[model samples]
Target: MAKQQVISPLPGTFYRKSAPDQPSYKEEGDQVAVGETIGLVEVMKSFHEIKSDFAGTVTKFLIDNEDAVMAGQALVEIDG
Candidate 1:
């Protein structure tokens, strides 16, 4: 099996939700499809969607929510 890559589309702090009190966009073992929005990256108060590059089940979460992330950063790994 190959691990699917979840990439950050911008340089910012990656957040799992629109608000702190909200649940995460996704979690491990969750089935995801290509082009699906998995998370958000905040840059200068603007949020950008981080999408899945492949269809698979999420196997790992590389970065924690609210963590500073760079462009192209690996956010999650999925088993494809």
Candidate 2:
């Protein structure tokens, strides 16, 4: 199996769930499909959905929920 990384598209705050009380978009060990939303990035009050570019099992999240992230920062690692 090879590992792939999901990168942040823009500098902002990374959110694992759509809302505070909702479940996370993807958890470790979860199977993710291409174009699946794994998280969101909030910038200047605008939210952007972060989607996967490849299908694989979610292996790990590099940053915690609501953590600050930069553009092109590695967020999640997926195993294929």
Candidate 3:
């Protein structure tokens, strides 16, 4: 298996769940498909969906929920 990374497109606050009370969109060992939404980024009150470009199993999350992230930062690792 090869490892891949899901990157953030813009600088913002990363969120694993759609809302505070909801479960995370994805977790470690979860299967992910191409174009699957794994998280969200909030910037200036606007939210943007962060999608995976690779089809694989989610191996790890590099950033924690509600953490600040930068553009081009790796958010999650995928094993394919």
Candidate 4:
């Protein structure tokens, strides 16, 4: 298996769940498909969905929920 990373497309606050009460979009060890949403990045009150470009299992999350992130930062690691 090869490891891949899900990169953030924007600089903002990263959120694991849509809302505080909602479950995370993808958790560690979860299977992910291409174009699947894994998280959201809030920029200036605007929310953007972060999608995975690779199909694989979620291995790790590099950024914590509600953490600040920059464009091109690795959000999660995936094993395919």
Model 3, span 1-80: residue lDDT tens: 99999999999999999999999999999999999999999999999999999999999999999999999999999998
Off by over 4 Å in 2: none
Candidate 1 local lDDT, 1-80, one digit each (tens): 88767788689998878688988878888899988888999999987888888998999899998899988789999999
Kindly indicate the candidate among 1 and 3 with the higher lDDT: 3
Model 1, residue 2: distance off in Å is 0.8
What do the candidate models score in CA lDDT, each in turn? 0.86, 0.96, 0.97, 0.97
TM per candidate comes to 0.91, 0.98, 0.98, 0.98
lDDT (Cα, tens digit) per residue for candidate 4, span 1-80: 99999999899999999999999999999999999999999999999999999999999999999999999999999998
Show pairs that collide, candidate 4: none
Pick out the ten consecutive residues of candidate 4 with the lowest summed lDDT.
Answer: 50-59
Over the stretch 14-49, how does candidate 2's per-residue lDDT look in tens digits?
Answer: 999999999999999999999999999999999999
Location of the lowest summed lDDT over 10 successive residues in candidate 1: 1-10
* lDDT at residue 21 of model 2 (Cα atoms): 100
- Report the error of model 1 at residue 72, Å: 1.9
Cα lDDT for residue 11, candidate 2 = 95
Candidate 2 at residue 17, lDDT?
100
